[model samples]
Target chain A: MTLKAQHVSWRRGGTLVVDGVTLQPAPGSTVGLLGPNGSGKSSLLRLLQGIAKPDSGTITLDDTDLALLRRREVAQTVASVTQHADTDVDIVVRDVVRLGRTPHRSPFGGELARDERIISEALEHVGLTAKADRLWHTLSGGERQRAHIARALAQEPRELLLDEPTNHLDIRHQLELLELVAALPVTAIVALHDLNLAAMFCDTVVVLQHGRVITAGPPAEVLTPELIADVYGVRAHVTRDDYTGRPTVTFQPGPPKGEVLRPLQASTSVRSA
Target chain B: MVVGEQGRALNALTLPVAADSPSRRERQWSRYGAASVLTLGGLIVLAVSVGVAVTLGPADVSLVNVRDILLNHLGLAEIPVRVSEDAIVWQERLPRALVAAACGAGLGLCGAILQSLLRNPLADPFVLGVSSGASTGAVAVGMLGLGGSSLGLSGGAFLGALVAFGLVLLLARFASSGTSGVILAGVASTQLFSALTSLIMFAFADSDEARGVMFWLLGSLEGMRWNDVGLSTAVVGVGAIVCIASARSLDAFAFGEDVAASLGIPVARTRVLLLILTALLTATLVSIAGAVGFVGLVLPHAARLLFGQRHARVIPATIVLGAVFMVWVDAASRVAFAPTPLPVGVGTALVGVPVFVLLLLRRKGRA
Candidate 1:
């Protein structure tokens, strides 16, 4: 149930995409990864999922070294919904979900009765059951993203990983999907660009800057005007909302030159909204 | 306490899902059933075509005589026929027709495998230069007196085909664009091999030798014997079984490497195995039939359109459809031109291009 990485580093070409980062998500906890573009969120997720090996470090799922396990073994325990999962050929949504049964399937067996149920349940969870028969190419961008999520959910894995799963979603769908992810009874690590959604959904938040972990804690503790001003360099109004008591980050409607970086990490004044 | 309601709601919501599933499964199974029926129907057409194709030729053999000859050979029934007519039907025509069918089936399977493995709809064995390379080898041996017998020509062609396959792999490895790079490399190798073939034909061979080489290049089953039939049957039969076993691997490849790897398929190993197997299949067919064009490329698409994108259905359908298409094409070549033997390859492309274009147009129209 515990998924962790220790001092992981990965280099692509001449640049260090993920540099000396360690992550450990608590069992059954949803961890939100907050990072600017090129800050290594996707790279870190790839390394954690055992799709790409880190140059110098170790990854373990449930205390077992991930590199030691076969791809099938890793896939059986860990499922991921990446941002860029598209096929050139024509396939239906249900068939795409059925692919999640790969690790559980026998070498020569047909799609089993159990596999079909899981696939259907995943479709139902994503509210894509009605669109199951539609060709993949005919799906809208947000629907495609949801279909990928359904495919990942069909795996019924102990750990679920997603990278920017809400990229193409409309506002309503974005909220619904985050709600669904938070409600799922499995460990999750989601890379998110939205601080408010992360604050509202994730139990723990980790922020990355320039391929390094800058800060990590519970969302209420970690999110601050100082962190937002420092990491994102945008003037953001930080406050505790009356109902949820979660720290909400709203960018102030002003020019970038209107704000200055604060000196101390814990020194930002917060106003209740 | 709040989470408990949604959990209960999710479970309750999925119960009606149970009500919806049986009919869906039935629909899916029936679609698959229809695919199987289509394949069975194709097999029947192939059987009938083979029987009819054996009767079609310059030889004036009656349909009843053709039937009696076939039945007598099978030991199902006995009827007397002239030895000459029996020889024409049994020794000459039957083996040729069967060889056409086997070559067709093998090439179609290779085409489908190549397309899936490469994740490119337009990809086929010929796109990898296997056919061109085989022609170079066969021409070098058969026309230039390098290898005296047809057997030597076949061996030379196979070796050349392997060379082309290796060259394409090496070039594609160095190239950055991966699949597209492989295709570019194949085009380069095909041009190189085809030039070599042309050079030998013009500079080395006399008129009669050149004509014989031309016949082989353009694909004629004129002198196909029982041995060719037996050899092709063994190769295509074994190849079809291998393809069927590998169907799941092919299915995983439709989405590309990362997704396929996540699906527990060994992407690199499977790609290598599929490419090599398909190359071997194409090479075998090329040696026997001299690179019969279009069947390998078009029939797979036709099969997929008919049977759906699943390789499980497409593979069987392709085999049957390819066999039947080639049988009719060969028969049309034999009878339409009379004493002037039409190259089956030319005839295949002549019919294939229009039909393939219509299929493409129809697919777009459907979309």
Candidate 2:
């Protein structure tokens, strides 16, 4: 399934938060959204997930317009793991995950055996099988994040949209979660604050600045020191790892006095090392 | 292979499985059994409450006497009894007890549905100002001497409840979010209705009118008749069935609105249905028993503590527990002061306050 955003723009409270941004990810590939705070990465993801309507253009999945589908139908095609994770009710983990089977269920029918099996498989994938019976409030923050992902997996969608999935997680869980998402067969669009983690896991990276796609391609080409300094206003050194062939960005504190940064490259480049 | 064999053995020991064995059918049975047990318990409580309430009245009637009178009345037994004794047992005590049970069950079911719909544990039918609205209506009829009839008072109370509910829904619509908006609207409507009630009472300050309004506001099962019992029972039955039917939607709502919508639930429609159902139940109950409070606010939470937060369990458990609670409260009101009866509402509040305080203390402790 190919997911594409076509010249999408969105405004919130009269402010154009996302403007003429487009991204397309191939089937079964992971695309990472990289941006500084207030760069509209989350807004773009919400647009793609059909949670927010684009002001100008269209989002499509496999050539089908997303606007034509119902909310539940969109949910079936693209499951979301958003940042707001607080639940008012106290429910057990298994029940929370079982809610993912909701879109597939008829109004009066109970969860089928196949649905239960899928829920169990999702829980096992997240290593939350043991915690399935635990109350939601009793779980730690990382566990709750994993539970949210498990819920998304329970939707059994063809694509997953994540907005800051690792925001509240510790370092180990963060790496584990990204690694897991990287291995999944479904196409994924993830918004990340940490550039190194994004570079390490994503097959493609799209960098945003002030609601526009400043650069888009492979991580190595887009995460260069000059690009980082121009978009983030931070001086950084870009290097390559010999073993992994991935771009490793290291910030090189303060730029020269009164030396203005260069503009970001208009065309994206895909480099192999 | 060994684990599979063990699982089969356990299954066989539990129940014989034929070629037609379907786990889904078995799971459905389990759900039925759980609901059945709660229903049976509630029925048993209802039976015991009726017996105890009848026997405890000032007429010096025994359990055997009460039973004999009931059986004779039903044409199952022939027993000679004084007409006044029969009157006290059948006409006086039975209607009051039935009204209390019906009111309790209605309040409890309404509370459970409201809490789930609003996603606020503190939500109750009265919290939205329905009871105050009903009181205002009842007081209006009594003060204005509008026909001086039971039907007039009941009609006035129902109208008050409907107006209050309509105002709350209209205000809630202005909120940008769902649950929080409803709660804020409820708070605002509650204050408005309460002030209106107070203003009405002050405008008609006759001693008799004031006492009548005060009694209705406090809620009472005194002077109940078969008409009141029938109204309350019908309302409770309808409310309970509607709440049970919506249990699955309530479960979905526990996750939040966005999630609920994504899960194929029509969130706005379901919320409107719940609000209307609870309002109707509250109006019926207030018309019959006056503005009884706390039962609807507290019983559902108490039920949640016993059964988990699953609405399937919480809803039924609340009905049973609420019935038992009200029956006992009415009995205590009759017997606590012997010849002089305290109002049933006074008894419930006196009891509900301590229990509510205990629940708060426990919650604080847990926190």
Candidate 3:
């Protein structure tokens, strides 16, 4: 049940995108991979999902190298929901979820009773049972994200990887989606953009900068204002949410020092006037 | 074991009672029932279409006479029939109609597979330049006498189609290796081959050779025989089996390649195998029936509109619909113009453009 990446590094077109990173997510925990743009969060998720191979290091599941296992064997245990999973095919929600059963079924076999039960349960788990037959094109962004999660769930995977699953979602939906992911029984490694959301939902958070891990620990310790400013180059105030007892990040409206523009200054002056 | 875990998690929250709900189960049944009924209906329509179309030529062969010829030929019944009517039904029309049906099914299946594999709705054999390459190959053999001694026109066309497909794949790989890249490369190949074909015809072919090549290029089923029928059916049959076997792989590809890889598909291997299969299917059909347009481009969308987007259902539906559609189109083209038969490609375009425009307009408002 162990999924570990030891000293993993990957490059794209001669540029290093994920550098010398090690991640070993504990079973049944929600771990957040947080970083700014081009910080290698998505690339790390890709490596963990076995969609991309690390150039220099190894990713192993249950002490065996992922490169040595067959793709179907890996997929039966790990399901992934990509950040921008959209399709133009005139497919329904249930049909989208049916794709999760691909690794489990043979090439020509029909859907078995067990498959149907699992698919139904997955949809139900995501609170999408009523909208199972709705057309995918008609779904809202939040609903589409939920449908993707349900599709991942339908794989009956022990480990789930999600890449920015809350992007384009409204605040409430973002909270609800994270809550759902956090409560899931499987170990989940999520790449997220929202620091507060990551802090609220993730048991532990790992921050990356320039494709290298800058900090990794419980969100309360890792998501400090100094760390946020150093990694993201933005000033932010961090506080603990009284209700949830989690770190909350509030960003400063103005730009950082030595980068203040005329338009921003004028806007501030206008607000004062 | 995991079900109990999921159950416990849901029990901790406000759980819905829809897990294994009877209503959802009934809906699933109805969906499958509808698909089964449609498939059965399509098969019946295709069979009837071939039979009725065989009776539509200038030979005055009746439906009963055509059926009797088929039955007699199959050794099912021994009904005495006129020699001319028997010849018309068995020797000529049946083979032509069957070949037309096979071409339609094969082309449509290729289109369906490409649309999914490439993640683009406009993907088809013609769009990928396989038909155009086949045309060029056929013309090169027929006009310039290149490879005529060793590879016949069909063989030359098959080679040319594979070459064009390879060129498109290489160009797409060098440029972007995305869906748009493949389609753009296909466009470039199509234009390049079409120009080459024209150059060959203009420079080398005599008027008689030019006229014959022109008719074939526009897709004619004028003199098809039983051998043609057998070749087309066997090719399409094998291709269909292979495609159906990989239906889950195609389903996984509904999203982009990255998502498909996550689903445990050997993305590169599956894509290359299917792409080559489509190329072979297109080349064989093009060599048999010439470049019949629009069936490949139009039938898959029609099938998706009728049935849902599951490749398991969509592929079979497209095959059936395309076969039925081509049989009628060929029959109409044959009988409508009397002595000077209209090209089957032109007939398809005439029908296909309106349907294509309708589908476009319908999707204009959707996301």
The CA lDDT of each predicted structure is 0.83, 0.80, 0.86
Poorest lDDT segment (10 consecutive residues) of candidate 3 chain B: B10-19
Which tens-of-lDDT digit does each residue in A1-273 have in candidate 2?
577899999998899989999888888788999888888988898788776789999999778888787766777777888777578687889988887877776555654556676788778767899999998999988888899898888887778889899987989878878877777767889999899999999999999877989889999888887677666767787789888899998877665224454433321221112
**To one decimal, what is the Cα RMSD in angstroms of model 3 from the true structure?**
5.5
Model 3: per-residue lDDT, tens digit, B1-367?
2456446554533344445656666766776678788889888999999999999978788888888899999999999999998988888899999999999999999999999999888787777789889989999988788885788777888888988988988998898666778889999999999999999989898899999888888899988999999999999999999998888899999888988888889888898788889988999999888899889878999887766688889899989988998999999999999878999999988988897788777766553
| Candidates by lDDT, descending order | 3, 1, 2
What TM-score does model 1 achieve against the real structure? 0.89
Q: Which residue pairs show backbone clashes in model 1?
A: none
DockQ of each: 0.34, 0.23, 0.40
TM-scores of the candidates in the order shown = 0.89, 0.85, 0.90
Q: Best lDDT goes to which candidate? A: 3
Q: Summing lDDT over every window of 10 consecutive residues in candidate 2 chain A, give the lowest-scoring window.
A: A264-273
lDDT against true structure, model 3: 0.86
lDDT for residue B7 in candidate 3, whole number 0-100: 66
